[model samples]
Target chain A: MGSETESARRLLTGWGRTAPSAAEVIRPATTEALVSALSRRPARGVIARGLGRSYGDVAQNGGGTVLDMTGLDAIHAFDPDQGTITVAAGCSLAALLDRVVAAGWFLPVTPGTRFVTVGGAIACDVHGKNHHRDGSFGEHVTALTLLTASGDMLDLTPEGTPDEFWATVGGLGLTGIVISATIQLLRVDSSAIRVDTERTADLAETFAKLRASDDTYRYSVAWLDCAAAGRLGRGIAIQGDHATRDEVDSVPPVPGLKPRISSPRWLSLAPILRSPAISILNEVHFRRARTAAGQIEAIEPFFYPLDAVGDWNRMYGRGGFLQYQFVVPLDREDVVHTALELLHRERIRSTLAVLKRFGPGSRAPLSFPMLGWTLALDIALPAPRAARVLAAIDEHVAESGGRVYLAKDSRLRQELVDVMNPRLPEWNTVRRRLDPDGVFQQDLARRLGLTGASP
Target chain B: MNDAFGLPSRIVVLGGGSEIGQAIVAAIVAEKPADVVLAGRTPVTLPDVPAARSLERIEFDATATESHGAFFDSLFAAGDVDLVVLAFGVVGEQAVAEQDPAAAVEIAMTNYVGAVSSLTHVSTRLAAQGHGTIVVLSSVAGQKARRSNSVYGSSKAGLDAFTEGLQLASLGTGVGVIHVRPGFVKTKMTANLKAAPFATTAEAVATAVVAELGKGNRTVWVPAILRPVMWLIRAMPPRVLRSL
Candidate 1:
């Protein structure tokens, strides 16, 4: 019984690696064992943890048991005709993508990295660049098995447990642990993306072109100039959609089963971790993209450009980094401009700043996305008075009824969260039903007093 | 997962205020602890347990047999419980017990009948959940009845047998019962008594329980050598054993 999992008390930290906490971690091999552990009613409580990619303490439970769900990774069911896969919550997107891609199917939504788990994606309701075209990750999920605190398993679907299901999605793993899920996948002819690259002269051009033609592209994302003096926000806008069989034919096939132009590996490029380094790289990258470029690229490089470099997170240095993502209504385009200027004025440097348009607010109350523009900025940790900078930006957002992403936030004030998520009361009603005893808890929940685990 | 020292994560000691039970909880938590639920009749004094996120103290009366079902149902419904320590028992003075049949019955009911009621509920709940361990604190006093504490001995003897039955019944269910027998342990229950030959301390009993749990043993005789020594005690002539 004292195997690798036993006697191995590890210091667990979220993906940000900022706030580390010691915890007893157990990996249950089967669904029954997992349920038993959950049903035991430990005083410290337990929370299901996946790959821990959240840039905050959402996955860590200080002085509690963190159920390492990664061990329960299983591709349980797959129906080729339906183009859907029923998989364990712990199955990583990378693994699922590999299997489905070979079968001419692709994930309905994928974040910037392919390392996230289905459970984490659902808990965070992770939104990808194509959220404007489709929706957040939760929209495609047809059904999932929710194991409540009482150890009873509930088959929750978009229809079966409407309120509970939506509440579970983006509910921050507080309602219950996602045992397994069946999600709809998009069909694709080939494993490639047809991309068009355009260099925006300034923020004006970028927003104009994006707002004008975002509907044309299934996926679109812009790499912004975080350190621009005169031409701030001038960078590259990359737009793409799954390549059809005809487009695949138009682009000459690589000789001898090899890609003609091997996808550019991010590692081949010089490290751009520091603010100054990123500024120079952005300048050069922007200049190179002044001319329009169109190419057929592998699906991976196009969707998960950062995944090409293993341990890319280390680039943020030992201090780690924070991904502060916020969304303001479309009518408040001024909020987006004011926000970039505020970061510049505050002298808070962000190495990677991205701007994307969201189609409409998701039905999931706590979800990060809503109609209008969402800006995600990755700022290195230990920035001076980080709280102040975030609070200032949050004020600008809150005034316009905008909200920050809970999955990525580490410093959002409790009161601020209450004000931001208006659907909190509705979500709480359903949450209490799933975990009435407040058995499921984590560091994030404890800090914010979510799920009544505070006492 | 056990603690960094490889102790279990969540453990509930039924006799919340029992010195020996508290010692076991302290020892386990001191080494490795995620949560500790000390359930007993009295409010517990929590140890300096920084590693545990929660040290829940619940008022649990062992003689309340009728409430065992709802108590355990609520406990299981609350959260994930990994291990349960059935450590509630009392040794009524043999003189007082023999003089008053009611006193003897009270001793028997609290020590034997109460445990049966609690353990039965625990066994069923854990088995239904498909995982967990129930560690019952039996005693070597049950190995053979001496005149001085025959009443206590008889109670433990009944508990030992009941636990054995539950252990066998739990096979393949993932839930298991462990019977732990300590010989004349110097605890609060035996504070003023003369130390018997080979008598152990509560701390020693706690250490043994922790070690046995690590080994996943179904039966543990504290001061491990007692396994063979008890055989000799059982074989001793009743005349000689009674004299001692």
Candidate 2:
């Protein structure tokens, strides 16, 4: 570790907006180095940033050291007999998924985006289409090596240090920096996914179909047409599970099948993304998808479609986009429809509107899932009249038994967060117990008043 | 701006009828606090604070301590309160207060004991929940006992200390306590007083408080230069300072 200013200058967090002008970004390639670094700066807060996927400030800590975990990505040990893989926290989910699939294993849970790091997934307690079945990523973490605020290295799991473990699971990197994690992986037949697609006429039909069919599939999601009104919640529901090698051959080949092709690096540039030429390309791309029921699709097409587009977030332009994700309890399904109706009534266009069924919630106080339905919409920012429209949605969600996901929220009131997640106090208590001095702090944490500043 | 964090972050001035309080509330409400709650002893007849979504009223009486808890409980029970401006107090004539001990006691209780008890209850709940900020109005006149308005000054002194303690106790707790101390504000409370140095209006104090709050400061003295002046006043020998 260098001087405080030096350490502070090197921190590059996920999503360019939150990267600290870190004086020094410590990349501990090994556990010993990580431990040494922690011992050296016992009083400073450390945030572990992986792959930098969080849209806002979940992983960056200004004026403090950032432990870039990506360098510690190597898998330490794989116990095939126990189906547990102990790896460094810096490992990317995409890399983990690829390696695990090759070994007939898969992550018990994965969020929509696979580029996230294992530490990030656990820190945010990320969830996915399979949340209705498997729950959040934290649910599958068997154990984690947490370097506490006091520089004590503790191995935590659901059974060991249960409270601290659960709190750190969704603690948003406030508890301490995660050095490594041992995750329990699920066994799968093959890397391919056997998917079935169906288009629903409206919201009611979609809900009924999901309620009836979700239990049969391991992963389920709906591409909602938020612009549709009256019928309100209409969209295409796609459900799937891991495909056996035999089932993989039955599906029609995707038009462009280059399994070995690497993502083009040039696509990550901002100028190419913001040009009007890309919008036409996007329009053509949307038009190419043929609407059909019971259509079989490949796993890559269904799950990681966006992964193919390098730096897709750049499409939203320099202002970036805000991902508004909230879940309405089943009891408040009517409120969900009312909210969708209002969005449709306003004709606020969101490029990506995903609806999914959540089975039950995890013990994490601010966890985003519950026994009901969740809708996530990615709206391009700087759109005309977008603020007013989002406010209307926030009011509707508050009235219902729902709250937005903090991991994805760039904008939302601190007060509304209090209402939506009443469990925050309990979680904060745990955070204080671990970080009594309030060493850990981030932009999102500050914005949401998670950590009190030193006077 | 309210949506920046995800809820309506509006501010409401309970005593829009108050000149100094309303000016402070108006300035804060301008920064946008999601919504404004403009409750008063009676409906305030004034222009609405700009940018505040709506100004609603609930009949509030500073002297009505018993009703304070229920009134505030019901008000904040909706759970939308992010920042509350406790600007309800009375500054009666010193001669009248001296002649009528009961009136003086009422002023003392309303400004110090009554307000503290009610706000304590409110702050307790807000602290347990770990959110919301309480903005309490205090005066530099309370920094020490003054001959002109010792009764009023003493009441403010108690409030000022209580708020400072609240701020200290609330550390590590999500709830925040902001003590706003302004000097010589040209409001009804000080309208009868002779002109003094560094005299400011309610609007000016309010602007300073709102700006300082955004900077995450715990306590603020309006007309900032007065902060050093206050220190100087504190350092002066008692006999010499009294003569001034």
Candidate 3:
């Protein structure tokens, strides 16, 4: 009997899997089916869910109807001449790349994982390590089809419908369900990256090296050893760009897009993921890197190394882990140091930490990337003192004119939303016009008070 | 919503007057400031815990079973509650309970019937909200019934069973349940009774339960030894149990 009821209601969660909510899920394989699902108008409202890789509650609609767009995944068109492709909102980047990579094309921008759906990418306005060069995913989108609250499909683009287009970009799917989208892909000769590796002595050196080579490198990121006490900010900087035919040894077999191994559900490494063990792991990783330049690497290892280990999040245990990512302006780089010092003082250990430099800010109101340094880290749950310490850092970041990434945040305070995302009011104005009835809602919207008082 | 450390930002205590209940709230507030709501039939004075951000009291009668559905609906309608401690229960004297049928009925109604009614409503609300922890203060008395305290023991037994099942029902919903079993916790309710073996205090039970909340533990035994002791107590012969 319990199994019957449990099967009826779908329990949804983000990649982090920290907070889960149950909802009635409806998969629409066609436009007509999507419209039929939308017409139901559940009392709690409706929202769209993709591959569920936003890291938080961005894709969840608790007690409401969730449109599982994965069923509508069909590549509508492909224009190799124009370097563009039109795919369904539910289409995964991995699937799209698999079709395009062999033909010398790639996603203009991508996050750490390629399993995310096209709709989620535009909804989050995801940025890659090349954010310093190419901006965000939304910037590369040529056009999109939005199904508004009133049940009207509107074709939108940056120029044709600036307000609605930008609103849908990093909109967290609150505006409406995205039906389909046309994205401009980057042209590549081979599926390999010519990389340059540098081990920085400290945070300042890493920042200086990144800033010094900002224009020279098309893509760059640093892996910081936050757990190392004396060598607190020491890191390894990896910068690279797509390799031409001459740069790689036969293009690495067109790059395998699927995950080779999956992490078992029963296995848990939480006990050993503590401070002592993590510090040792961090030390070994730091020492292992060499100052090698022009190292040829496959696209898989260069961008999505963790993706190879499927369901890697299970390693954090059932309590789940949080990925706290915040971006501070270039001048406020000291905030990064303060956050690391505070975490150390509170005796909190971050298992993984990545530091990246972003270029100019996005036009979209809720977009996360800006011309600054962003530090993202993962902390295993039940860290008793982590709340107070992270809240303190949130305050400092807000005051320093920085913002945390909503796509990755699970516990950011509601009051800090306005201060961090100053353009929230502007986004709300556009969102209200598009969804005046407020038919689309999500858990992240309610938790962070993103939307005004509930309908 | 819980913060980064899993510290509940908002907490609700059903039996506001229970010493063990108030102690649990104190333990949480000691860690960090949180908004607390104490609900009971009798109005409870705001505890002077400086760490608590805000303390509010409301009327909540355990025996009023029919009103539970509406009561919880309104409570959750206001906002999401992170932690809810169901501590409202009466410990009636077994001697008086056996002699007076009405007394035994009152004890059963308050502890078992009322718990079922209120917990059913609380679970529905928390499950819909998708994130929260329900802490149930069960007892070692429920481990096995004693001839001396059969009525009260049986009442706890029912609650213990219900809470265990509720924990399973709540799986995958992100709602956690902590079934707390304490042996002879010395509180105002148990002040008149003689202290049992390996006796503990209400504060000690509170500390253990609060610590277990962050660990994702479903069952907590105060003083820690009651768990092992209960094992032996359950295995004892009926003839040997009757002597005690």
Against the true structure, whose DockQ is highest? 3
Query: How far does residue B160 in candidate 1 sit from its true spot (Å)?
Result: 53
Over B1-244, each residue of candidate 3 has an lDDT whose tens digit, in order, gives: 5543456768899988888999999988766667788998867553555567777788998999888888888888777787899998888888999999999999999999999988899888877866678899988999999876789999999999999999889987767888999889888888988888889988998878867664443898887998998999899998988887
Candidate 3 clash total?
0
CAPRI accuracy category, model 3: acceptable
Tens digits of per-residue lDDT, candidate 2, B106-221, equal 87988898778767876776554334567788888788777777788889999998888888876544455668888887776676788668888888877666544422227988
The candidate maximizing lDDT is 3
Sort the predicted structures by lDDT, highest score first. 3, 1, 2
lDDT of 3 by residue, A78-160 (tens): 98877799999999998898888878888899899888999999999999999999999999999999998888999999998
List residue ranges in candidate 3 displaced over 4 A.
A1-7, A269-276, B1-10, B26-35, B44-55, B80-82, B128-131, B146-150, B172-174, B201-204, B212-217, B238-244
Q: Write the per-residue lDDT of candidate 1 for residues A81-150, one digit (tens) a residue.
A: 8899999998988878767777778889989877788999999999898999899999999999998887
Q: How well does candidate 3 score on lDDT at residue B141?
A: 91
DockQ, cand. 3? 0.35
Interface RMSD of 3: 3.6
User: For each candidate, what TM-score against the reference?
Assistant: 0.62, 0.63, 0.92
lDDT of 3 at A168: 93
| True lDDT of residue B103, candidate 2 | 82
Question: What is the overall TM-score of model 2 with all chains considered together?
Answer: 0.63
Model 2 spans with C-alpha error above 4 angstroms: A1-24, A32-45, A228-232, A250-297, A452-455, B1-244
